[model samples]
Target: MMKLDFDDWNIHVGAPHPFNARAVPKIDNGTERPDPRRYHDPDFMREEWDKVFARSWLLAGPASDIPEAGDFFTFTIGPESFIVVRGEDGVIRAHYNVCPHRGSRLVTADFGSMDRFTCPFHSWKFDLEGRNLAVTDEETFRPEVLCHGHDLTSVRCEVAVGLVFICMDTDVAPLSQWLAPILPQLELYDIDKMYVVQHRRSDWGANWKGGVDAFAETYHLHAVHPQTQGLMDDRTQIDLWPGGLSRQFVPFAQPASRYPDQETVNPGIQSMLSDAGVDPNEYRGTAAEARHTVQQAKRRRSDELGLGYDRFSDSQLSDSVVYSLFPNVQIGCHPEAIFLHRFLPHADDPNQFTYDTCILYRHVDAPGYRAPAWMGLAEGTDMSGGTRPEVVHTPLGAPPGLGEVLDQDSDLLPIVQAGARSRGFRGPLWSEQEGRLRHFHAELDRRMTAP
Candidate 1:
């Protein structure tokens, strides 16, 4: 018999980050169940934005999305708008979206290449470096205010793991410092080189935190995504880190303990074997043997296809790692793809929020490669679709092709939002699995009052 270690690949695994030295925090204090008003109260939403969203390093967009100079995207959080663009020097920067002359928006489109940005209202112009180049009537205004470098108010911006992160607080720490604990896991996969195969955004009637609560735990999967019960281990192992970061290492291709008759091959195991290039119908082993078999099969398959995943251990080949960034981002990292979902507070409505999801892949040319169906991909469908990516926009509750598992969550989240108002409902009760949610709110509280 063996006590299998699910992590550590026996390769050049680096020492744990200094922040990971302590044990993960528990939900012991009165902080377990947060006050429900934080979800739908207008004042609370405003307070959170001022304290959390305004100061945190939020995921703006991917650097790969804006590769060439002049490539840019608009990220709107709360009432503020920012433009993330590649400067002439091939560096990425973010600037406030207001025109210096009349306070009108400078860039109007979601994304595009522009030689420079010109305000539509007064035609004030600025280059990609946010340098003021021209103004329709420069002589009309006082020279002091004019010479004050009205270009575009530059906001704090930096790049990490191919994603652009911007902070409204100019004095905020660098991205690396803000995200130290999770850096090792991010570098494990060379995500900066990956391509965005699918991008989606939807407006939901749930508060931003409410939306975060929904995706933060796997406890809901049994009731909401019943179809996945037999395929994944629902009882997950969670790890918490400093700077309000947490991770849940989810085991895949294994049946839940709830499933009886573990010795015989189940349909889920059979499907996993067949997808890994093993003939499940020809497999002479029991269901319990499927995980080991699939691991070896995928490793051999990766070598045969020339996929460059030398840094990944066999356990990482099929298991899923879900990471939660403070304020409002949840990511599911898999060997095949990175599932990133970002939630933002609705500008005016406390009960509404917007979610943006991006699924990035390595863009390998292997024909036998298959993205897991849980990714909402159909059989035989090319995940790349020629690798030229385009984000599909849908209102909340629409099927964004994220597979049946999350599709169920999409349909039920709105109702969950409405349920928050029921007088009969108390605040959330924390189980050990949902400790990440408590840690998230604890950080928010700390930041709200922390000098």
Candidate 2:
């Protein structure tokens, strides 16, 4: 039997708050768009980078990425390169990946295990604890220069529900305070125990917010994502929290017809299904049996995480949950696997953003569970060097490549970027269904305008 923290889990309801809260400046949907100036002006972007990005809690990484002492991973947070390292003492910490001496970058590689960070420029050495231990010229430099206070600048970092988050602000409230309401639900993923199986990166000509907004709603799935339209229908629903976090539920079931021959075995679902250890044979026969078997398997996994024991009781489990942790990180939790996408801004222009996709699932069983068709659909090929991955280009005509069908929703981004600047285009048609978007922009506006 798997042991888990049951008290940390709770029911996930997509209901609006019952009581009225603090007053937020409301946007007028009747006339004028959200200022186009906000997207293009360097001053505006800088202000946001300082007020919004600087003082907020951004998802940095998960503990699983650095399971053992001395393990570390490097990433970018608002033009700043951050390194999350598990020290020799088994404590995980975040630091600005810059050398204090001559301002050289420390640790240029993506990730690895190291006892100390040595600056390539001047050979300045520091331990995994981030302390300035050795200096090149001991005679010339005063003792104060080697003091602990003069060591690497550290950021406030914390782990909750298996997800790692870092704050640039030193005086920010405890992460648990800001993430309390949703922490219980997030614990269901057992993310702390998960590891990254793949990492992908690409650049796009769109705003960072646009990249985030892309995954905010599924109302466009049918029309925008035609290939997977049937996979994600209207029954899907989304629930949003105050801190730029949201959970989307979409129903999915094991298809009996898809793997007819493998009646006694589970069809390969890449790393995802294999991790859950679903019995391939048990999920055969009628649609009811397939659904029942899949649900039972999910219950087994959830039970291991100490979450949602009653979730499988529902017959039609038609929803997949997509969780977005403010500003940039989005987690697509499919039953078979987990996908993470992060949007990083490259320039002052909100029209340009970097898109990264990382998929993590258990490796397929060794003597082998391989299904060509199933694998093809799950693993998107690398066509980055050729045409853009997936973008909606109506006026540009259909995608001329053959990797994967680029849909409208993906294409709609550049248009929104262009429209945001046009006198004709302004604010969006903000609705209750688009509550997450509304909440996101509202919090952004508040932070950007804070004194």
Candidate 3:
């Protein structure tokens, strides 16, 4: 299923590519101690708002979330808000969440469907295409004021590999230009057809950068989520890219170096095999063989089973090639499903942030079939069984807060935040393996300080 190159790509199936590139400057922002104020200073947070959050392109949600005309969802980050909507003509667009009339917030709920958005305060209406349809008191207001081009202030929106992204600022480069080097890598797993099966949002006690930092490197993996030791080799291999985007390749379905016996199948491998819809007992090979076995099985049966996993390579199927988009999105590109995380800053506090998690799987109606084991869903579970998928929200630091692995992170991040301000505490000294962290902060520093 893996092509030697992307030459034979059918845009409908594979992402067409000449793989345009944005140059990544050789820079290291990680050699020095990360300023502790980045986690808690109000002034630093303001700088981030004006420079980073306001200008960068952000992942609103999947295009599949609003599959029908007039369906829409609201994505709010920091103080900015936008609505990603599917138009009557089937085009996906994003509009600012403010009414042009009185500046009252237009869309209240997280998601809904409508022919037009009627301002609750003054009843000024706008169509799904963001056209200013009707004014409450048309006769009183002069035509000069009403026709002054106050259509729902459209935000810059673009779609790639199925995600709807919005840019708050008006002057940044196009999304494609920003996504240059990272786009082709993401194209490996066809994302346009995938549907979100699990959506979980949780507010964390740490800063947004802290949340992003935790997932960027695996150096903390053996310490924070010790139970996950053998699930994969967590010694992270950081792959730097242009525009602060990078990836960490962690070998999956294989035991970590610390595991006692690499010859036999570890408990982690057995659990993974069972979760992947493969019977570990039925596997007649060693633990090293389990990963390839699942990869080959998934590739061979993808079309027959209706799960479109044939696009991924054996390495992609078993290992975690987590592609991190600049600023706040972390995309875990897997063979069967894609794991995503969006870290949002708090409206007022730099010390607090929210972590939004979504797991998207290839949608199929086949019975007795299972998606990737990462979601902890029952083996052979049909996520498409329901009319629509439901997003489950849970408070962090609670039982079943996005499952066990995340629960550990949830508990630890808050403590890390508390320690950040300790009188004796010094700044963090990252190891070479966490060079991705240095690369990210380097880009962030450039962006924040750039004119």
Candidate 4:
């Protein structure tokens, strides 16, 4: 009962989709091969820190992480660390994690609640607003030394669409303006109403950009994650926007075109149907109908539970609308929840980076309401915002403890990094599906080569 043509599987160009209706001009980043050195050269990495990381608005963490006054979390990028805290006045602010005197790092814990930040090294104290409270035997110091402000140096911090972003360069555009290209689309999810259900950070044996390139597209999914072929369509519709923003709309609950038997309702499709409150035994349609079936079932379930699915389009309900934010963040948007992935660079090693993952869920009280099974949240995850979970840190080469798809990525990226280092290899020749990678590198190249 559904069209099986692979070429026609994607959303029609200039179609009437909700996200596409916005006035995002499509950008055609030329087909230039990216330099391999950008991934592993230490000099290139240093330049990226100066040009891109320092000048751009980087996603720090969820605003939901600090819901109350004095609640704070630490986010480290390259050689610097920042303390993002909600002040008593209900304003969220970020300050350098280092103490002004003698440069000892403050707030070693990942997250906590405190009226004042006390430096463990010398007992120097600072208020939640980053105002220096105590000087630790200040009378011994000269007036000129003390005259210099002891207050913690503040970083430009702003919140948009429920995420906190910090910019080291004070002169850069405001967060709203920088994200103007995709902000409206992001707002439709009501991300501020969601809460972090799972958080994990692990060191990976790849450059931060390597991780970014891996996630920018799904061209490798059929080859690397064959298990997903049964449930996810690899023929993704790529949309490129300005400011290095791009998204791929991949239909779910349907078999990939490469699958030999597209007529059968496979196990993956059955599981998705069950998650959507549909009985697989009663699903009398072919595999292509599975996506629509789940979408309608989810709609019915939402209406019965007052879950408010009217605002979302049918594609948004049953497809993986994954967005790749420039530099190092990728977001997977859905009605029930959202996935946030951050690839953070290592301070000293060009061959290593940290992969941070957070799963945010919009809480609903109905017994039948739940996140899609494809989200792969761990068993016993706390959906309620009752208690925030501590971040789980996994060492390099150890199991990331993320889902199966991500674990496969973790294992494969290092090999890709190693391959990039080989003398025989020249550079990556991207295909049409890899437009996001080209767009991202173009932005990076633009920054690196700027006057």
Candidate 4: tens digits of C-alpha lDDT, residues 323-374: 8887899999998889999999999899999999999999888776788887
Backbone clash numbers for all candidates listed: 2, 19, 0, 0
Ranking the candidates on lDDT from highest down gives 4, 3, 1, 2
Q: Rate the local accuracy (lDDT) of all candidates.
A: 0.76, 0.59, 0.77, 0.87
Q: Tally clashing residue pairs in candidate 2.
A: 19
Candidate 4: which stretches are off by over 4 Å? Answer: 1-15, 21-24
1-451: candidate 2 lDDT, tens digit per residue: 8854321211222223321121134232232235556665678788888887888888776566777898988877557898899988888899999998777889877778888999999888898878888888777877776563558988898988666788999877899998775665555545554455545565555678877776776555555564443222334445556666666654444322222332323333322234335544443454324444445555665566544545333322223566777777788764334667777776456667766665544333333222212222335543122211332112224341213532354466777778777777556766444555666776677677778
The parts of candidate 3 lying over 4 Å away from their true place are 1-30, 142-149, 275-277, 302-311, 365-368, 378-382, 395-400
Preferred candidate (lDDT higher): 1 or 3: 3
Colliding residue pairs in candidate 4:
none
Q: Write the per-residue lDDT of candidate 3 for residues 1-451, one digit (tens) a residue.
A: 8735321210111123122121246344546776777778899999988999888999999888899999999898898788889999999999999998889899978779998999999999999888888888789988898777778999889998899999878899999888887787787677777787777788888899888889888778778888777667765445576788886767778766676656687777887777566778887787666777766766656767755565455566667778888899999987557888999999989888888888777655555355665656534444672444556666645554577888788888889999987866676787676777787787888888898
Highest-scoring model, TM-score: 4
lDDT of 1 by residue, 1-451 (tens): 9955533311111124332233445424344566788878898888888888888899988788888899998988788899999988899999999998779999877788898999999888999988899988878889888877687898888898988899988778898987886887787777797767777777777888887888888777777877666777666666676677887766677776566756777777778887787887799876656777877888887788866565666556666778899889988886677888898888888988887888887766675576654676444444664544556777755665555665666678778878887786787787656777887877777887787
